[model samples]
Each structure stands twice: as C-alpha cells, then as structure tokens.
Target chain A: MSEDLRERFPEAEWIDSHDQDVVRIAPDQLLEFGNVVHEAGFEVLADVTAVDWYRTRTPRFDVVVNLLSMQHRRRLRILVGVPDGDPVVPSLVPIWPGANFGEREVYDMFGITFDGHPDLTRILMPDDWEGYPLRKDFEVGAVPVQFKASHQVN
Target chain B: MTDKTIDDPEIEEVDLWVSGTEEAEWDVYSTDEGAQKMRLEETGARLTEQLGSVVTDDYDLDDIITEDERMIINMGPQHPSTHGVLRLQLELEGEMIRRSKCVIGYLHTGMEKTAETLTFLQGPTNVTRMDYLAPLHNELCFSLAVERLLDIEVPPRAEVIRILMTELNRIASHLVAMATNGMDIGALSIMTYGFREREQILAFFEKTTGLRLNHNYIRPGGVAADLPPGWRADVSDICDTITGRLTDYEDMLKENPIWVGRTRGVGVITAEECRAYGITGPTLRSAGVPWDLRKAFPYSGIENYEFEVPVGEHGDVYDRYRVRIEEIIQSVGIVRQAADAMPKGDFRIDDRKVTPPPRHRIDESMEALIHHFKIFTEGFRVPAGETYVAIESPRGELGCYLVADGTGKPWRMHTRAPSFYNLQALPIMMADSVVADTIATIASLDPVMGDVDR
Candidate 1:
C-alpha cells in the first residue's frame, strides 16, 4: 500500500518513521492523496492533530492524519506541511465526515484552517480566545490566577 | 385608580359559520371617536383583503409552520443530565428534536499543550487526568507511545501486569458507564448494583497501586511499582465477586421489561453511521463491528489473552448496554488468566537511566547515589522520532501521538481521546429523536467531558 501510494503520487515523500508508514505530501496535494488512500481501503480517520515546529522547520505546522483501515487492519499516517504564511489545508470532510470535529480541534488548538469544512468554528476553545494555545510561540501562563477569599463561619 | 369589572358580553343564539365572501368580517359599529376609528377600520380592511380568508380558509398544515415555529433550546453547560458541562443547542418542533449541535470546551484545560511542557517521565502524570474514568488506559497509551519512540521493550512481567491492570480498569470503567447509564434512563436500582461492584474493583486497584482513579502505575519503561503482596488474591476475590454481581445485573436489567422498553430501540445508530462518526469501543461493537484494538492491534501482550470480543446485532441503546455487560464478563476472564500466568521478574526495566537505583544501594554506594542524582536531576533523553500508539480504551480508541526532539521533554504530545470522537456521534444519534430521549442518548454515548474537552 505504501508502494502504491508512492507510485500513485511520486511528488509526495514517504517516510517509514519508527515502523509506522508516514507519507509527507505537499499541502496542495493533501486532498488528492487523501482520495487515493481513502480508495485504498483506509476508511477510518483515527486521529487528526498538528505539530508546530514554528521557526525550527520551514513549514510552521505538520497536520498529521492517522488513517486506519478496519478491513485491512493497518494504519497509515499522512503528514501535510502547511507553511507559515498560508497555514491552510483542504478539508477531508467531503471524504470522511469524522474529520469534522478533529479538524476543528486542530484549528482550535493550532490556528491551522481546514478550508472546505462546512462549519470550522472554534472547538475546545472560547470563540474570543486570544491566540492558538498549542502553538510553540504562544506564551503560556499569560492568564493570571485569581482566588477569591473564602467565607466560613468559625 | 378604582378597580372595576368590565361588562361581560352575553352569548345569544348565533350561527357557527358566516358566509361573508370567504373573508374575515368585523362589525363597523364602535364607541371610539375620530381618527382611531378610521385607523382601526383601515387596518382591518387591509388585513382581510391580503389574508383573503381567516376562519373558513382551506390551507395546508405545513404552510403555517415557519422557521420561527421550530424552537431552539439550550440544554446545558449546566444541566445535570448532560453528564458534564456540555451545552447542547437543540432545535425542537413541539416535542420532537429537529436538529442538535453539541457545544463543548467548558472543561478544556489545554492538557495537550501542558504535555509539551512536561518531560517524558511526567507525561503520563498529565495525561492520566484527561480521561478520568479510565486513567490507567490514558497513562498506558502515553507510556506505550514513549516506549516506542525510545525504542525499548518492557519486561515480560511488566507487560502481563499492564494487561492485568488495564483489563481491570476496563471493567471498572464499564461499571461506571452502566451505573450512570442506568440512573440516566430511570433504572435507578442498577446504579446501586453497578457502583457496589465498582467500589470492590477500585479497592483492589488501591491495594495494588495506592490510588483509586488516577493510578499512574504504567510508566514508559515499565510500571511505576511492583505489585504488592497478595495482589493476586485480591484480584481473584474481586473477579469472583464481579462474576457473581454481573449475573445479578443481568437478572435486574436483561430480563426486566422496563429496562428493555427504555433502551431496546432508543438512540439507534447504524453500523455505517458509527463508522462515519469514528465511534468505537462498545458502541461500535453494539453496531456489530468486531474491530477491538485489543483483538486487532494486540498491544501490551493483549494477543495472549483468551477472550471473546462481544458484539451486538442492533446498534441501539440496549445493545450498547448488553455489549458493555458482556465485556465486563470477558474482562473478568482475562483478569483471571493474567493472575494464573503472572510471571516473576523485575517489574521495571533494569536500565540505570530509566529506572532509578535501589534505595539500599543508594544508601550504601556513592556510584549509586551519583547515578540516582543524575537521573532525577535530568531525566534521560529519547532519540528523535514520532509515533502514534493506540489501545482499546474503555470508551474507544485511546491513541497517543508523541514526537520527541532528542530532549527530556516531548516536542509535541497529543492524545486522540475516544470521548471526543464518541461525543461527535451524539448529534447523529439524537437526530429526529424525541427531546426527552436526549438524556438516554447522552448517557449511552458515555463521554467523559475531561476526555472531550482535553
């Protein structure tokens, strides 16, 4: 199946990292690659998460998709690198409806957008939240802790 | 101002229907004077002409219902039946739910972001809090991913112990689901029976790990501590009690008509719908899918366990209940086997860097003291790599995606929480159901809000 992926999309880079089949596709080729893989019996999109290698890597974020085939009982990890300027990837909602909330979660945490998602509103974060909490550059402990005085009768 | 009763109009012999040009008619006689009378007459005339007919009008019932007729009700970020701070925006037409959308994030603590801050050793400590119901599974998944990234194998005894603990944890988790689900569905007695059995299992856990819920016993290299003396005895006792109690539960719920009536066909989701929503664990099994990670992927020596993957024919609330009930029995069998085949060896790996030196050696030898100091002061670094490891958690597929940057701390750590994906199916399950059945549906989904919003 990895070989098939490589043969089908020669432009994409396939890396077998730590016994897991990981394919690195161009940001634009995600939808096309996803379509081929989805056709190749990987039905379940098990997970969708993002890695923010802000200044260390050329691409700011690596949107990771863990595709699992219930029939084949194999997992394939697809990584699409979205660069800093655009920070967008074509949504996989059209192919797999399960990617809806997962993509929204990734967007909520990392501020990476899924372009074609029907409702890509912030999930797991407040609508007025200031910045992407999962980004490497985002400052932690920015919000101060307030503890009100306790009132108890002696 | 004086309180006065206005004169009441007396009913005379009158015809029920009026044949007045199929239009609304109002009497022109009035006590009003000047422009008010003229304005009322003009408004009446305009309304009658535009509307055409009022009382005797022939109209389709659907035409009268507009978008405004369907009411939008906010169920909670506070209601008790939602299980947690899950706010549901439900569109209702009378008592029927037209559409529903779940609004979460009330419990989002940014644990994934916090995981990036903690070292690999401390990673489990943070993640174990995510799915509070099944914390052992959370810790085990995280530890497994780290172990894979580090390229190390745990000892045999450690693997068997992990299987033992997590299986027990699965049973405990199932008990909570059963208890809460029963209470939500108005089968109140089942809650008492379920929790009574659950407390026994928790007692066994506390005896082994010294904590009830968030036992961070499973570490990267191996478990945190060796199983205490007579652990097997306690496990066997708990297993027997649970085995007997499971029968009681069956007697109470399985044959009871009220239990069956409330749950038999409520919140039904087809196998295809479950696959589309990525629902897993017992809910998927209830839909007749035998895709259990323990059976499929076989991590942590799960392949050795002799157990049956219980499945249901119809994907209804009752089927979900049956699957979980049968699973608890299967888990008990696995626990008994693990106890019988319990190996005697080092609980943790013998590597000095991963596992600290023995306390006796630390007191005696300077070399041991130095090694312990170095290990504690600066945790061991893992080789740079990324891996995703998933296990069959009680809720569903609990996966941990870890990326190490050749440092003590992880570069990025994300837990693919089962409750998060499982909760997404709530809208799918609640679609076109009664507004009242939302409680049964939410209870059956069994989403831990901590897992959902984490």
Candidate 2:
C-alpha cells in the first residue's frame, strides 16, 4: 500500500515509523491527499491531532491525521508540517464529517486552525480559554500545596 | 399579555409528524433579553444548524410549523438519564426534536496534557481513568502503543491473560450499558439485576488488579501480574452464572412489548451515517456493518479465539440492545477459550530494562535492587517515533496515539476516545424523534462521561 501511495504521489515523502506508513506532506496537499485516500476506501478518519515541536524542529508542528480503510483493514497516518507562524491546515471535514470534533480538539489544544471547518470552536476546553494547553511552550501550571501544620523539612 | 383560555378557537391542534426540513430558524423576539441569553440563543441556533444538516435534507417546514412554536431547550449536564455530564440542546417543534446539539467538556481534566509529564511506565495509570467503566481497555491501548514504539513483545502467557481480562471487561461494560438503558426507560429492576451480575466480574478484577475502577494493571512490558490462583474456576463460574442470568434478562426485556415499542423504531441511524460519523463497536454493528476491530484488525492474539460478531438489521435502539446482549455471550465464549489455552510461562517480557526483577529477587540480589529502583524512578527510554494503536473497547474503537522522543517521558500522548466519537452520532439519532426518546437514544450509545470529556 505504501508503494502504491508512493508511486501515485512522488512529491510526498513517506516514512515507515515502527512498520507503520507515515506520509509527510505540505499543508497545501492535505485536502487532495485526503480525497485520494477517501476515494480509495479509507472511509474512517480515526483521529486528527497535532504535535508542537517547540525549538526542536524547523516546521514547528506536525498535524497528524489517522485514516482507516474498513474495506481493506488498513491504517495510514498522514502528517502535515505547519510553520510556527501559520499553523493552519485545510480541514478534512469536507471529506469526512467525523473529522469535525477531532479537528476542533486539535484547534483547542494546539492552537492550529482548520481553514474550512464548519464550526471551528473549542470542543473540550472552555470558550474563554487563554492559550493552547497541548503546545510544548504551554506551562504545566502546577500549583503548590500548603499543608495545615507541617512545614517543609530541609 | 392577553388572557388566553384553554378554549381559545385560534389555537391549532398540533399533530406529531416527521418534518423533512433541513434548516430551521431561531429568531428570538424579546425586547428585554440579556446578553447572556442572546449569546446562548445564538450558540443554540448555530449548533442546531450544524447538527441538523447532517441527517436531514433541505426542505421547507414553515408552512406546517411556525417559528414561534419552535423552542430551544436544554436537557442535561444534570439529568439522570444522560449517563454522565452530557448536555443536549434540542430544537423542538411541539415535542418532536427538529434539531439537536451535544454540549460537553464539563469533566475535562486535561489528561492528554498531563500524559506528557508521565513516563511510559506511568502512562497506563493516567489513561486508565479516561473510560472508567472499561479502564483495562484504556490501559491496554496505551500499553500496545508504547510496546509498538519499543518494538518488544510480551510472553504468550501475558497475551492470553490480556485477552481473558479484556473479554471479561467487555461483558461487565455491556452489563452496565444494559442496566442504565433499562433504568432510563423506567425499568428500574434491571438496573439492580445488571449491577448485581456485574459485581461478580468486578470481584474477579479486584482479586487480580487490586482496584475495581482504575486498574493500571496492564502496563507496557506486560500486565502488572499474572493471573491469580484459581482464576480458571472463577472465570468459569462467572461465565456460567452470567450465562444463566442472561436468559433472565432476555425473558424480561427481549420480548417485552413495552421494551420493543420504546426502542424498536427510536434513534434510527443507517450504516452510511455511521461510517460518515466514524461510529464503531456495537453501535456500528447494530447498523449491520460487522466492523469489529478485534476481528478486522486483530490485536493481542484475539484472532486466535473463535467467536461470532453479532450484527443487527435496523440501526435503532433495540438493535443496539440486542447486539450488546449477544456480544456478552460471545465474549464469554472468547474468555472460556482464552482460559483453556492459557500458556504457562513468564507473565511479563524478559527484558530487564522494561520489566523489573521479581520482588524476591530484588530483596536477595544487589543488582536486582538497583535495577528495580532505577526502573521505577527514571523508567526506560523508548526510541523516538510515533505510533497509534487501537483496540475494541465496549464503547467503540479505543485508540492511543503515542509520540516518544528518546526520553523517559512521552513527547505527546493522545487518545482517540470511542465515547467522544460516538457522541457525535447523538444528534443524528435524536433528530425527528420525540423528547422522551432522547433518553433511550443516549442510553443506547452507552457513553461514559470520563471518556467523552477526556
């Protein structure tokens, strides 16, 4: 399947990570690639998430979309590299409506925007949330606990 | 305001009919409305529009029903029948739900964000809380993803044990679903009966994992421990007991007129709608898809066992009920198979880096002590990569997406929670249905709040 995908789209770089096929493509090619796979019986959009590589990689975030072909019993991972400045990727909701909440979750957590989403609002977080919590730069925001009678022993 | 009486001749008698309209307008005409009220009204309208179009086709219903007769109402976040903290905003035209939207995130604790700080060894503990009803399945998915990244395999004994425990967990989860479903529909006795039977399974789990709810027992290298002594007898006892009790459930609800009437035609979702919405597990099977991940994409040697995947013709609430009931029986068969074929070998992998030495060895040997201490404190590093592993939980496809960075801590840990995706099907199922049937539909989906909000 990877060989077939590679033969079809030579511009996209395919990497086999732990025996799973991951095709890395530019943000512009996400919708087209999604359509290609959708036409090829990859009907289920299993998940859509983004990873923020703060200060480690050039194209700072990788938007990962997991697709499942129920007909063939195969899975494919599509990765789109978005620059730190513009973290926008075309929404797969047009192809797969199941991507609605998953894309909204990515938007809520990683601050990445889905350009063509029907309703691009926060799904899991509050509407008034300040920053994306899943980004690498986001602080864990641990609060110090104060004990009633015990003090820290040095 | 004019004093209107019940005998007013201008009022029209509303009859229930399934409207073929795709769009409806929510126009609030109040001069003294507050900002909060306006914001809520707008959100409700947007949600209705977003959700209504997925299941309905564009048509005009203005001639039949007026805008004034259509009102938006909130169901829960507190209602007993919502399963947990799930809230629904329904656009109703005289008791019939024209459109609906699901409002969630009341229980979001940011577990995914918290996963980045925990090591692979502690990963199962965090994920196990997501779907509290099926905690072991959550742990199993996470452990599978981590093991895939590490490129290691557990012993045959461990795999069989996983299959046995997970299949038992499946039965317990389906029992809860059946119980709550019955309770929602006002059959309160089934709730007690279902929980009573589920206690046997929980007791077995407590004997093995030491916790009833969040058993972080399924770790990355393998399960936390081997099966307890006399497990085979306990498993067979559970199977026999539940197998007998299942007939009672069938006799009570399967042919009951009220049960069939309430659930048969309510909450109908087609196979195409399920595929488009990414609904899996029993819900999809109820739509006659036969797309069980355990069979289609076998994991943890589940394919070695012989079992049938039960499917339903209509995608209604009753079909879902029947599918789940049959699934429990099938799960019992798988458990029996796994127990009989259970291998006698090491419970965990033999790798010293991933699996700690035994407790007796750690007390005797100095090298074992250091290895145990180091394994618990720092944890083992996984090769830098990303992997997504999915398993069939009671709800649907419970998936774990893990990204390791050559460090003890994971770079990113995201769970594709089944309840979260299955919740999307609520609007489609609730559309064109009555206000009362909403409870039946929500119960049929069997969504856990922790899984939905996580």
lDDT of 2 at B29: 23
Per-residue alpha-carbon lDDT of candidate 1 for residues B1-454, written as tens digits (9 for 90 to 100): 9454454345355656654433345442232111111122123422221121212222222434567677767898899888889888776668876556688889999898898888888888899899989999999999999888888899999999999999999999999899999998788899998888889888888988889988888998999889888887899999989987777888988989988888887777777767766788989999899889998999988899899999998888899999999999899999999999989998999887688898899999999999888776777798999999999999999999999999999999999999999886776667657877889889888889999998
If scored against the real structure, what TM-score would every candidate get?
0.88, 0.90
Candidate 2 residues lying further than 4 Å off, grouped into runs, are: A1-4, A142-154, B1-51, B55-64
Per-residue lDDT tens digits for candidate 2, residues A1-100, read: 5667778788999888877878899889889888889998999988888888999998999999999999988899999999989888999888888888
DockQ of each: 0.36, 0.44
Clash pairs for candidate 2: none
- What is the lDDT for A119 in model 2? 70
Highest DockQ: which candidate? 2
Please give the lDDT score at residue B226 for candidate 2: 84
